[model samples]
Target: MAAPVPPPTEPDASARICPGDQIGPCAACHRPTHKYGRGARSPLCEYCDAKAVERLGRKLRAD
Candidate 1:
């Protein structure tokens, strides 16, 4: 027997983000990361995740 498909539901979930064709912000820098590629789970497309990590280190060192 074939499996039944679930109908589409309304999008009201706060965490349910659906980027039609745009990339999300970087988790670390919180900057726009669309120039690189389509994504939003950290490790922005424009730059590497390490870049942000380094910046964090610098900030912590200052304090």
Candidate 2:
């Protein structure tokens, strides 16, 4: 058997606190707010976050 290598980890990823920011299988539909400071939190891709939030807000208002 051969030794296995750990998956690559992004620097500062430990502070990641978003949903949509997660990529690949871990990617989610939404991300959390960036509180504390810019570097303290994880930022989702602008496009994904904006669209999701817009749609969600519209749905809620409609209801």
Candidate 3:
């Protein structure tokens, strides 16, 4: 038998944004996003960033 999978967890508040951060539209989703750390370079919203990380993780695990 296999174990049940856990539900996806939400990113922490710190992952969302920080003080004095810039806001802009996401390059991929065109939604408003806060520019923080590397996110400033990619301009991807938190949702899109999470999706992208999940996709990359799956691809890496498959290889």
TM-scores for the candidates: 0.29, 0.24, 0.46
Candidate 3, overall lDDT?
Answer: 0.54
lDDT of 2 by residue, 1-63 (tens): 944422334322323554444333213323332333333433443444445677786454323
Candidate with maximal TM-score: 3
Model 3 Cα shift for residue 63 (angstroms):
22
> RMSD in angstroms, all models?
13.4, 12.3, 7.8
**Residue-by-residue lDDT tens digits, candidate 1, 1-63:** 944422222221221443535545545444544423453355342233445556675454323
| Residue 49 lDDT (model 2) | 45
Model 3 misplaced regions, further than 4 Å? 1-21, 37-39, 58-63
Please provide, for model 3 over 1-63, each residue's C-alpha lDDT reduced to its tens digit, 9 standing for 90 to 100.
Answer: 844422224333343565535655566665655665544665656566667778786454323
- Sorted on TM-score, highest at the top, how do the candidates line up? 3, 1, 2
Q: Tell me which of candidates 2 and 3 scores higher on lDDT.
A: 3
Query: Which residue runs does candidate 2 get wrong by more than 4 Å?
Result: 1-43, 58-63
Candidate 1 vs candidate 2: the lDDT winner is: 1
Screening candidate 3 with a backbone cut-off below 3 angstroms (N, C-alpha, C), the clashing residue pairs are none
